[model samples]
Target: MLNFPLWKKLMVGVVLVWSVLAALPNVLTPAQMENMPSFMPSKTINLGLDLQGGAHLVLQVDMETALKQSYEKMEDDVRAALRDRSSGTRINYRGLRSNTETGIHFTVLNPADVPTVKEKLHSALTGVFVLNEGTNIAVAYTPEELTKMRKHALEQTLEILRMRVDEFGVSEPLIQRQGDDRVIIELPGVTDVSRAKDIIGRTAQLTFHLVDESARAGHRLPAGTGVFYELIKDEAGTVLDKVPYFLVKRPALTGENLNNASSAFDQYGNPVVSITFDSRGTRKFGDMTKENVGRRMAIVLDGNVYSAPVLREPILGGKAQISGNFTVTEANDLSTVLRAGALPAPISIIEERTVGPSLGADSIEAGRIAVVYGFIAVLILMAIFYGGFGMAANVALLFNVALILSVMTFLGATLTLPGIAGIVLTIGMAVDANVLIFERIREETQRGLSPMLAIDTGFRSAFLTILDANITTLIAAVVMFGMGSGPIKGFALTLSVGILASMFTAILVTRWQILAWLMRARPKTLKA
Candidate 1:
């Protein structure tokens, strides 16, 4: 234990130098970092919502709207099933409609067609119960199926919310499900609260519907057409007028087939949203445009028509562009939401809070003060009690902190207020191993052992004890990180990193320092 290899010493030196350099960015101002070389270690620890101050939102998912949408899709499927003639002759149907309360209901014109219709519906629709009374048929989702759909909707909403937040480019965002129908979002460093809310709440449900040219907007004589309005808004987003459009109820294409979307400039240098569809979407869109060469296809988003462009030719390659009189920000936001995909259901913000930068500054100051004072107190106490060896321990403690910061920065971990508390706690615990080893050395010295043998025996004896204590605490930290949410996880992460760093410093670093000193000084009696 007393013998130190040259390679071990070199390894220790490399680690210390790397840690100091990696942790340097935290101490430097942004302007100073900019002045430094580009290849230098410039990444810093990310601050959490509590440390940086941003938007806090609690959103409520509208499950009823989701159910209604599902029923509408089911109604469409049922209509197509009755019309399908591949198996046999098409069965005639009438008065087909769907609602959340009554599900989907339609009547078969021929009583003899009921059995065939039932068979086709059963084969087409899975997880639904179908019943028929004479010529009337009612279809509803099973209880298990409803539960499954709700679960799936909630999960998809969470995933889409995460994707939207990631695209917004906020750092260290905390997005998690709060309850069955609620989502909690924390966006750190986000200044535009209204814009964030708008982006998050917009459903971005995109669909393409063929325009009904013969049907007027105000006069509704068409059976399978609906009146949709296109809002003409200025750059400030205030609607000036709403031009009504008569479009087919069933969409020819939906955003589900979209592969990618981006904001780009048109031929005239105007901002537009360009979209590409997947292979499935490419085939369907090609067929639709081929069938309706002279008709207009309206791009509807969230019940509003954005554009109604005429199909001059069959568009191939699955690419299309939406040109609206939009500002660059609006176009970018629309492309972002489209690329992130639409929310399965509508969500409303039930609660919202904006955290001020001043509060974050105060919290950071408070945490810094606590860490500095606590660290200084520990250093002073160790030096006063153990003399030269205590000073070595204090040096090791500093390196331990550097290691923790470097590791956190490398892992891109978020630093919260509780994380600071963990660091403070680590500062005190870092010296425990040195204290134990020093006490053991004192006992060995009293037994008249040589200084070198006493130091060696002390470290060896205390090694197992130090390892056992730190390992248990490390396990607890891992458990906390795995089981706890948001703030608790942050605390646990810092604590876990601190434990590993402290072990490296207390056992290896301080031991190396003491051994090097003894080899040079050749002390006859230990001062520790």
Candidate 2:
């Protein structure tokens, strides 16, 4: 099997090369050629959070806000189901904690409303909502229940945030829910974290409500009621006082169904993010505006009304356009948010850090000197020990360097300081495999074998020793990647990649070079 026909072996080589090249772009960067547009992915390097310096946010998303909203919604459902209220009503939250003090209470226009209250609260808080039956109806939630709900919402919001960040097109982002109330977000290569913060922090909720006419126009609602506003601010040159206000309901028309949001040029070359929604959102939007034709609807985002366009006719199709004061980049970003839906709760940044470019440059220079010095010292030691075949082995060393760089270029991996260290150590390890093989060859030659037999015997016998050494080191790198954070992970990844590349170069590449040299040059005897 090993002595297969030349063309058959070459055919296999061609297939292997093609297979590697086809899959190479996924793992290697240098497989694709530059200056051609067919398959070249944007060769931009992905910088780490420390190197590129992006936003580091430690935010607490108030799950309590969602809880209050949930409770209020249930209360509203109860009120509506009661038909007509008894002229006046007062309801208060005697929280889960206050259950021992003052239980949940509701006073109606008449005390007769008390009996019906129990029936109504029972049906409304059905899902995971526990009711403690006593002389009076105690509609209290438990702390554990609240925690459970919060965790569910927190996990959900984290997934949603990941989708939103993907839409934003940040290179390598870290978004995960932390405990019960907070989320941690790290965006690498974001030049302005403030802009990202503003977008992520917004609720981006849309709503529709008529102006409460016939009385004080700008006056706020009563204490318990919330008046949702479309807030606005003026530019430096623009008049701020002229900004008008409008109202929208709390029931938000979410942008979650939006499938695509991209900036396209109008006939006049102005920028706009073309929008499209999913099937359900399309029907809901069309139904909402069908009856209220000619009425104005505000497109509210981040508490500000961006556009207030009148509904000339129903928009039955899932497609529409968002046009505002926007550059191409700004329009694209706005569309990204709209396509990903609104955030569950507004976020606030509590922490940030950055690394300077000068420091990174300094590290690179130091790493270069260390690698060069290390390579020279190893070469000197190898030459002194083995005399002639050590030089043949040195040829193998250069092949290892080529293989590692070729793999990196093909994989599109960003080179870090730690990654450079991994490559340097890998170069030294490459020689260790060759030294084992060379020593084995010498031992076999001394024990009465021809030069060809000795060389073949060396590689065959040395295979297991080389495999064991590399395998153990590879396992250590994997464990380091698992336990370590950030920079350590980079080192592990680089070392793992280096190990694979080194193995290929040390075994296959070195053997191929040696076989060609032996057959063509025909060395007479072993040089040990």
Which candidate tops lDDT? 1
lDDT of 2 by residue, 1-528 (tens): 013357854853663354344433434445445534665443443545655556667777766566765565555565564554453544332222222223244444444555555565665665433343443345555667666777777776787678778877788787766556788787876767667776676665544343333224567654233344433333332434334544534433556566677788777787876777778878877786786688766665565555667779988887666655566667776766666666666656666554455655567577778878887887788788876556656765665555565555556655667877887888788888888888898999888787778878888899898999899999999999888755687788778877876676567655665666667777778766
| Candidate 1 residue spans exceeding 4 A from truth | 1-7, 30-39, 86-95, 107-114, 131-138, 142-148, 151-155, 176-184, 213-221, 259-271, 274-283, 293-296, 309-324, 443-453, 522-528
lDDT of 1 by residue, 306-365 (tens): 899999999988999987797899899999999999999999999998988888889999
Error of 2 at 61 (Å): 4.3
- Per-residue lDDT, model 1, residue 196, is 98
Candidate 1, residue 327: lDDT: 88
Tell me how far the alpha carbon of residue 157 in candidate 1 is from the true structure, in angstroms, after superposition. 3.6
For candidate 1, give the lDDT: 0.92
| lDDT at position 32, candidate 1 | 95
lDDT of 1 at 419: 98
